[model samples]
Target: MKLVVQVKLLPTPAQAAALATTLRACNAAAQYTSRVAFERNVKSRNELQKLCYREIKDRFGLSAQPAVRVVKKVVDAYTALHAGIRAGYLGGERSRRRVKAESKPIAFNTSSAQPFDDRCLSWRYDAGTVSIWTTAGRLKGIGFVGSADQLATLRAHRRGESDLLFRDGGWFLIATCEVPEPEVFEPADWIGVDRGITNLATTSDADNFQGRRLQRYRRWHGRKRVELQAKRTKSAKRRLKARARKEARHAACVNHSIAKDIVAVAQRTGRGIALEELRGIRDRVRLNRHQRAIMSSWPFHQLERHITYKARRAGVPVLLVDARYTSQMCPRCKHTTRSNRPTRDTFSCRLCGLAGPADVVAAVNVRDRARRAWVLVNAPVPMAA
Candidate 1:
């Protein structure tokens, strides 16, 4: 499994200036390369390199590897843009959004992250420092800090390119690590997780990860955002951005905690994890105005990703079961209908008279589906006909 460990850099004023200059130069070079690619209609890395490599090295003062990386970055941006168009993320061909996207070349932010290969960057894990190439020169002995586990992971499994990024007045490196996944053991049972805006997560074990506190936090921030927007000052805008980042960090932390606990339980119990296949959930479900606001910012997918990655790290299997009617199905009688859920949180089967919390019922349905699916998957093949 591939994971990223982020380490903060503590650089002297001189080193910091060099880092900033390098980042700006790389992004500026990238923007220039993008313009060239757009004008020539060339999206291949090799072609872009041939066209702009010399100019980048001379104009941006970048070395060989950084020049190559800048060209690659521009090509990757175009590739991603084309992919988004194909996937209809910008809407139909004639849509204004799609037209606007296609009309201009992709742009890179001034502080956009830059990738550094081994040739341009080297880590000294023992000394907690790094040596990296800059437009000024190679900066050596720049101190870095991370958690104990993160440092250990970097020392053991760090591989491939690391991204140098400047964010919130700090510099950080996101190092990629390839960790070996343990062999998955046979499961004794399954733990089903139902994701929702209100409950956040409800398991078949009847454990609830409520979102009330989070909702309150968001509402407070929402009010503050409106106030700041009304002010419409530069300071207000900066504060707004900071608050948004803080809220996101808080949500991510909650998700990490929830996923760790769930994976721990699954590993300890020798059970697999079952989650509803919730792709395009926003399109499938309808919500009122207030509910829509909640849904728009909901981190359901992030939570699912966290659970999956944690489960993978723990050697616990995860299954995505069908999501249809999970909230409104009778777990005991297998009766499915809209009326089965008479209220948002209550589930009462009209036919079988089974009743429970709606989220828990959904989770139980997920577990049942995983159980049957796993049986079919591992069922022995019959004699050849």
Candidate 2:
């Protein structure tokens, strides 16, 4: 398992300036590489490296490691485009967008960090001081501090590739570390969790985790965002942009908390977790204007991601089951129909007359489906010739 540990760095003023200059140079080379690749119809990384390798080094005055990383950054941009194309999420044969060079966070490959090669990014850790390689040169005796838990991991696990990040007037080292995978739990019980817009999560045990507070929070910010955006003044626009980011961060934090609680409950019960596989739901399902707005602001995917990593780390298995008819399907009589759920938050089976909270019913169905999936996955398979 790969875990990224962010360590706050304390660099001298000279080192900070040098790091900034290096980042500028690296981004410039990356931008040139991006422009050339797009203009020349270059796709493969090998072709890109051949085209820009020597020229970038000479023109940008960058060392071999920084030059190569620049090419890699450009290649990564194209890679994202290709992935989107393959997934049918983008509608274009090729991406024509060019990278504009800016002072942004940069990644350093193992080649750049010659001395630091473990399962994580190699760093010379002495007491609280660390030494890392930068494009300018090796910056030694940079102070970094992390929590006790984080420091314990630093001392235990192997580090992988590291990134130099400049955020909020701080230069930080983001280190990737490889932690051994925990033993997979063979669950005898399963906890079903239904995720929705109004109620963030409803477990099979009938615990309803409502996001009314978050909803109110977002709505308040959303109104302010619209008001500021409509003004179109420079200050308003800046505040609007900052508000958008803050809103996103707040949403992510809420998702993390919800996921933590769900996973913790499942762990306490000694059971695996079951979630709905709501892939491409926005495209698959049609909704009215109000519904669409709610769906757009929903953080289901982020919550699922948080649950997955947390579950895995805690040795609790998680299963994603097809959510088709899970809401309408009656857990009592196994009758499937749209009429089963005539109203939101209420589920009443037309055939069996079973009634309960709609979300809890769906969660139960999700768990049942996941139980079947788990059985099927563990079932024996015949040999094929």
Candidate 3:
């Protein structure tokens, strides 16, 4: 499994300036390459590299390695755009539009992160620093720190590339490390996880991770944000933006904690995890004004992603099944009706008179779906009679 370890860097003023210059040069090169490629209808990475390699170095005054990464970056961007188009996530004409718009260079922010590979970047674990190649020169001994676990991964499996990021008045090294995937295990049973707005996650096995505090936090922040927006002052605007980020950070921390606990439960129980595939759910579901606000801001996607990676790293398989009718369908009676979910939290089966927490019932349905899928895939074909 490949994971990113973000380590905060403490750089001197001169080193920071050099990093800024290097990143700016890289972005400029990428923009120029993009412009030329789009104009000439050049989409191939090799072709672009052949065309713009010398031009970027000569025009941008960048060294060999940074020049390579710059060209690669442009090619990668085009590749991603094409992939998105194919996946239907992006409009077919988006790439063409972007190409046509390249006549005017896009204004880049100061924090455009630059990528560095082994050729241009080196780490000194003993000194707790890294040496990076910059347009000005090689900036050495830039101090960095990470969690003990992250540092261990750096010492053990640090591979591939790292990005230089500047955010919130601090520099960070986002290192990509290739770690060994956990050994695959055949789960004896499966646990279903239903993610929601009220409860972050509820398991079929009767574990509920509450989101009431998180909701309170969001409501408080939302009110503050609205107040700040109305102020129309520079400080108010700044504080509003900061509050948005703070809310996001808080949610992310809570999600991480919840995912960790869920994965730990799965590992302890020797069970795989089953999750509902809720992609594009917000657009699909109809909600009232208050429900819309809460549901719209729900971080179900983030929680699912966190659970997935954590489960995979822990050797527990995570399955995503169809979420349709999960909340309404009764697990005991196998009856499907919207009335089964009489309220947000309560689910009562109309046929069997069985009732339980709405989220848990939904989770049980998810688990059953996964179990059926596994059985179908693994069950042997019947011989002709």
Candidate 4:
């Protein structure tokens, strides 16, 4: 599996300036290349490189590899834009967002991240430093720091390109690392995880990851955001952005903790993980105004992603079962109806009177579905007569 390890760089003032200059130059060159590609109606990498390579090198003062990377970046931007259009992410053809996107060439931010190949960047894991090509010159011995696990991963598995990015007044590098996945063990049973806004996650094992604290945390942040917006000052805007980043970091940390515990249990018990297939969940469900805000801001997908990656690393299998009626179905009697869940927290089957917490019931249903689904998945196909 491919994963990214991000480390913060502690560059000297001189090195930082050079990095800033190089990044700005590369992005500026990318914007110019994008304009040319738009004007000439050319998206092919080789053709666009041929047209802009020499000019970008001469005008932007970039070396051979950086020049090539700039052109490739421009082409990639257009490719992604076209892909988004095809996927209807910007809505229908006549929608304002879609029209606006198609009307102009894609632009790159001046501070956007730039990818560096081996020719432009080299790592020194033993010394915890890096040597990188900059517009000023090659900067050597720029220190970096990361968690012990991340440093170990980088030393053992780091490969391919690394991206240089400036964020929150700091320079960082995100390096790709390819790690070998362990062979999956046959599961003795399954653990079903039900994701929700209020509870966050409820497992068939009856474990609950409650979101009450997180909800209060977000509500406080929301109130602060409104206050800052009312102030409408530059400092307020900066503070607002900081708070948003902090909130995201907190949510991600919570998810990582929850996923780690669940994956550990699954691996220990020799059980597969079952999750509801929740693609397009936002589009599938309707909510009131207050509920809509909570739904939109929920980190259900991130939690699921964490679970998936952790499971992969632990050699535990994961299954996505059908989501329909998981909450409404009676796990005991096999009865399905809307009335089974009369309240948010309660689940009572009208037929057999089976009762439990709604989220746990949903998780049990998920587990049952996965048990059946796995049989079909591994079943032998019938031979033709």
Candidate 5:
């Protein structure tokens, strides 16, 4: 199976500035492309991806700006999309221009996206000494992880297959790598996953794997960010950089830990795993701004994705179940009522007097749905690894 190890990039100060400029250019590129696509009578099909890259060069492309393999990855996204469209995938065409409102102009704190393929593999992992031909000059030994060989499936780069982002003071590169065919297994046990706004997640095994720590860290970090922003001095700005670096490390560590835990639990059970659908979770939730953001960023989707791939690596079944009424329904008595869950973590059934932790009950219900879906549905199982 293929696994992508995104080692951090230690770009020079000049490289960092170029990256920031590239980000704005990318946003400008995407926005311009989007406007062209949505315009009613604009028939002159404009290729903004190429245009953006070219325009940025005209405006801010310094001869000394480091173009390295790192920034070219951004251009690769456009190339990949065009290739797909040529290959008959219409969706790729739309994604090439789907600019959302929140997509602020790419700035210093933004991560750039890059595409990867056999052609671009020249600089992907060329020994411990990494070098890329750039508009500026060759940058070497930036930081790389693992061998450069990639499986064909994951080689498809539609969106930010290689996503670079700036947050909390440092830059993070998240490479999207695909694994080989998944392994098939006869599970030894069964699992149910419950996702909720209040608690984040609860598993059938009574394991509480919520993002409490992440929330705490975000809160503390937010305060520090505010303190930094309140400052007008140059030194204070430098201090913010330190804080950002710390946050990036913490975020990655948190995500990796949560993913490992979820996978570990699945492996330990040696049984099929199931998770409630997250699509409905948001619609059903009435969350405050903070709660909404937390629920939205809980990484439940990423967790599910991590579980599926990790399970395949270990040979296990992963299932998804609809989440409707999972919380209000009593696991013991099969009693369903809105009154069954009146608060954050309590679920009590009026008819059966069954009371339990709300998330756990939902987990059980979700598990049941998975069992039913697995037994009766004809959905294709993922190919064995």
Candidate 6:
């Protein structure tokens, strides 16, 4: 798995200016490459970009290394777009929207840092110092002090991948490390997860994990954000930056914690985790402005990703079931109806006299979907091949 870890950098004033200059260079490089590719793709032969890069470099008196890196960046962009197209998804520079990868990226071979490659990027944190080998030798000033602990004991293993990047106006080290397979573990159990507006998640096992915690944090930051936006003063802007960082940190904490808990419960129960399919959640939210803002800010995808990664390490599998009618379906009679859920939280089934918390009923339904999916998975199919 490739994990991109971005450690905070406290650069000195002089270093900051140098890095800013570097960023401008990167922007110029990207802009130039983007414009070239746009022009090339318009022509009949877009595949001859490597030759084009050489021609441009020679014509412009630019070094091969940075210019080549620039070409590689654009190539990677096209590769991503092609992959998305293959997957029947919209990606890459398509139509009129070609957002180039503006981040300065430098690749390194794993032979230099094997074994420990999965976790940390060795090149990123070299000998407790940021020993980045960019087109411009070693980065000076604030760059060195950027890595946490100066990356003193960093090492990459044989089967690893590393990419160093400076993006979001920050330096980041993305490490791809291989995880060892577990000797004795299983991810075959069943546990239903219910995602709600009020509570982030509730399990079919009657266990409750409230999402109100996230709601609280979101509201707090949202209010401050508005107040800061209105001020527009220098001090207010500075304070807002700090506050924004704090809010992001807080969100990471909550989402990470929530994912960990769900994984833990799945491990303990020895069952697979099933989650509700929240459809059109982003657009269908009936929350107030503050609450809606908070809801939107919640990192749902990040939370799901955390659960997946943690589950994989622990030998637990995550199951996604179509939550189409889980909420309306009666866990008792298996009858799905909107009227059964007369109230928001109450699910009083008319067909089977089943009644419970709407979310809890939804949870049981989520778990049942697992069984149905299992049958679909293992059932014999008509021999066509």
User: What number of clashing residue pairs does each candidate have, in the order they appear?
Assistant: 0, 7, 0, 0, 10, 17
Per-residue alpha-carbon lDDT of candidate 2 for residues 13-70, written as tens digits (9 for 90 to 100)? 9988876776666667777787788778787888989999999989988767667666
What overall lDDT goes with each candidate model? 0.94, 0.80, 0.87, 0.95, 0.60, 0.61
lDDT (10s digit) by residue, model 3, range 1-385: 9999999999999998888787778888888887887778888888888999999999999887888887777777777766765675643455666545444433345477778998899999989999989888888889999899999998898889899888777889898889888886888989999888888899998799999999999999988888888989999987887788889999999999999999999999899999999998987888888788888789999999999899888999888899999999999889999999999999999999999999999989999999998888789999999
Best by lDDT: 4
Pairs clashing within candidate 2 = 116-122, 119-159, 120-158, 120-159, 120-160, 121-159, 121-160
- Cα distance off (Å), candidate 1, residue 349: 3.6
Q: What is the alpha-carbon lDDT for the whole of candidate 6? A: 0.61
Each model's TM-score, in the order given? 0.95, 0.83, 0.88, 0.95, 0.61, 0.68
Candidate 5 regions off by >4 Å? 1-3, 8-127, 131-178, 228-252, 288-297, 378-385
Model 5, 304-383: lDDT tens per residue? Answer: 67677767776777887787889888887888889999887898898989888888988889888887777676567789
Error of 2 at 226 (Å): 1.2
lDDT of 1 by residue, 1-385 (tens): 9999999999999999999999999999999999899888997789889999999999988889999999988888899999999999999989999999888888998899999999999999889999999999999999999999999999999999999999999999999999999988899999999998889999999999999899899999999999999999999999999999999999999999999989999999999999999999888988888688888899999999999999999999999999999998899999999999999999999998999899999999999999999999999999998
RMSD of each: 1.7, 4.9, 3.0, 1.7, 8.4, 7.1
Write model 4 residue lDDT over 1-385, tens digit each, in one string: 9999999999999899999999999999999999999999997999999999999999999999999988888888899999999999999999999999888888888889999999999999889999999999999999999999999999999989999999989999999999999999999999999999889999999999999999999999999999999999999998999999999999999999999999999999999999999999988988888898899889999999999999999999999999999999998889999999999999999999999899999999999999999999999999999
Q: In model 6, which regions exceed 4 Å deviation?
A: 8-20, 42-63, 78-126, 134-136, 139-170, 178-188, 227-249, 279-299, 351-355, 379-385
> What TM-score, to 2 decimals, does candidate 4 have?
0.95
Better of 3 and 6 by TM-score: 3
RMSD of 3: 3.0
Which of candidates 2 and 3 reaches a greater TM-score? 3
Error of 4 at 66 (Å): 1.1
Candidate 5: what lDDT? 0.60
